[model samples]
Target: MRSLMLASLLTLSAAPALALAQPGKDCHLPGTEESLRCLRLAVPLDHHAPGAALSLHVTVAPALRESARRDPLFLLAGGPGEAGSDLVPLLNTTFRKVRATRDIVLIDQRGTGLSGKLDCKPGKNAETATEDELLAETRACIKGLNKRFNLYTTEQAARDIEVVRAALGYGRINVWGGSYGSRLAQAYSRLYPGSVRSLVLDGVAAPDQVVPAGAHDAQAALDALLKQCADDTVCAAAFPALRSEFDALAARLAKSPQSLTLPDPRTAETTKVEMTSMRFIGTVHNILYSQADSRRLPFLIHSAYQDRWQPFIARSNVSRDFSSEGGPAMPLHLAVVCAEDFPRLTPELLAEDTKGSFLGAPQIMRIGKMCETMSVPAVPYKEPAVIEAPVLLMSGALDPVTPPRRAEAARKYMKNAQHLIVKNGGHIVSPLGCMPRLLRTFLDQPGAPLKAECLNEIPAPTFQLNSAGPQP
Candidate 1:
């Protein structure tokens, strides 16, 4: 799960499309011990043009039994930029039971993983790069790409999924998509309804959702975290001034960005970081994605308020690097965001969305500037019609980005769907307690009642009050 959170922050790269490979043979995916079969299928860069092609990397974890289900499960990755192949380890663990009867297919969506990735050199320090610097870097990256930036839209990616599905010889497939992948799953289902067996969308990002509007949801999640700490007796006693301390820290950083030398969390070598209020808040936002990290928030805040910045800096460094290690492909991220998301973001809408949010509108503004340079024509928004496929939508009640309400919004367009909200879960909840089993059950029997009462047994994370850990 930590890897999943960390991978969310990394970037992806791409090369020119290559010729399709022969049938799959044994292969090993990085970070996992499991042996899998790998295949490379050449796909058009632009489905409409078919002039140039990019080979997509696909991995197959075969079912244990020889007589497996005919319809396999396809895993769609999030980020709009994450390579589905990067999630093999998490999928192997979370869907271990499901693998007993169905082959699991993981495809590196066109511009990610072993596929034609869109690698952009990061700024000297992307974490602290100024808005102008970031935008300039984006422009340089766009100029350097061999492929058309506008060609990586979700619509095209959906078509690519069909191509892969056909090449793999699967008639219909069950899809499990997370975050931005949820939106992709919706697009794929809409485009190829007959090819889909069932859909599982975790952290649902609905078709009509404005990507920039996530600032509002993040703020709501932060507020809930603070409130939870206040309501907890142990947390309240340990950090009586936690809320005030956080505000004071943010206010102090806002007025004067800190220049500090701290050991790198990964290397332990001396490192310098420019810590601004936005950076501080952004770090906290990322931390909120995992229950373990959220548990340490009170301690992290109290320590920082006392001018003990090492712990906070180390955590921040780790978070930033995690995002970069194998996270999202920035160029591809820009391509999708510019084409599909930015069109719906207006200055008026952004202002309203970011009001009172710690993150503010800087991200939206930065992306808007980058989008301006890319010149990727905006994909028009369309209210998704009813999807008749049996769908299971799961959401974390405390997820910073895709809240339960987003799942509810998505459920409206599904003719056959069930939503399950994990009470103490955050971000992607499919891999949370009892969820993996519940998921396997749902896939095996889409219409069966989810015996999810066990979720109630999952306790709220114990807040870290001191170095010794939570009070007994």
Candidate 2:
């Protein structure tokens, strides 16, 4: 599910065999909540050639309570770009219930943080790169990345995982993935099926699915959000004119894609930019990560429709304090989306795809089109992980990135899998609300599994946008 074949083809420029190599045999996990450990385990940068030599990053934590511990839980982060090794504090808290029963592990995939990151610089801004600029930047980045690191795909990352498993002396490990993290979980299960005892995919992304699937799933999530809005008396009353208002906003933005200017939330710079349909979609898409975030959408749409640029401005503004030259990173994204999702898009499907989208698919397609120049063969990997070994699939009903449908589809592939869908939940639902305790119950007695009734008790999302009146 990655983007740059050109980037994958270039030879390393005298780079060491292991750029971020740290042998994990002696790796330590934190004893205190505040102290977390990260170490590099040498994995072949190219798994196809493991004996060729490369290094991978893996961080392990010994269980909080030694007696109740079962096996280590491998946490895979989404984005194929975002790294998970640094999220120990958050992960520990979210999975505390499970931690009491098992260790939580985080693996930062290649081309992401701390694992021989493919980026040239960290903390770069996205404000400067237009779609066109990003396309060019990606080509250059792929060339540069190929020279510095051998661009192995997710399949390679999975095999490297087994090495960590063997070195750690743990025969079995559990998996939990969110957003693009789901891709990692699927690949891991495919490559090292015997190594995994259980898998928990939050925001389940099916291995067979791609960008169009993602786009279609997000549209469904939006529909769910709209229904939630209707169910919320406060939200419905507050923005009864929501749908019509949304149409106006899109029509206006389409007429004048680049006329809008708002102070950048991160820098407060008054910058002129295109507020095209795709940007509109991009701006509000990730909010589906949680039910709490969904509650604020009505107000967001109403405000944007009403020419209240503040909502979009505040939401669209981003920072890169710890990101890897993160701007559009469009080039990498284009390569990935184009090959796996948009490449086979039919003309009619392409046209219909954007019909309902507030933003036309053309904008996303623009990136996909540009990516054709650097097309590479899709990485060879397994389908979604649905084996029957104590598997649990958790998804947010409103999760745009990986919707409930993905989980439902996974059920067919898995012999012994069961899914829990949080009605108002967005992306990662396991570590929050009632999920932790329910998960605790499941792991405490794997054979005597608790019915996922707690998920049923979870409340629906509150869809009231945070649109405030003047100084009220």
Highest TM-score model number: 1
User: Distance (Å) between predicted and true CA of 261, model 2?
Assistant: 4.2
lDDT string for model 1 (1-472, tens) is 1111222233222212323344676788886886788877777888777677777888888887777888788899988778988788885678888888888889898888888788775656775564356567667777878568888889888888887676665678999999999999999999989989899999999778888678888888888889999999878888888889988988888788888776766667787767776678878988998866788889999998887787787677664521364567877888898888888888788888888887777655657777776788989988788898899999988898899999998899999999898889898988778889998899888877687898877778788987677656
Per-residue lDDT of candidate 2, residues 3-99 (tens digit): 0111123233312233333333434333334444455556565655445555566666646674745477788876656666655655556777776
Query: Model 2 shows how many backbone clashes?
Result: 16
lDDT of each: 0.80, 0.61
Q: Stretches of candidate 2 above 4 Å error?
A: 1-33, 68-70, 120-125, 147-150, 261-270, 319-355, 380-386, 461-472
Cand. 1 Cα-lDDT: 0.80
Summing lDDT over every window of 10 consecutive residues in candidate 2, give the lowest-scoring window.
1-10
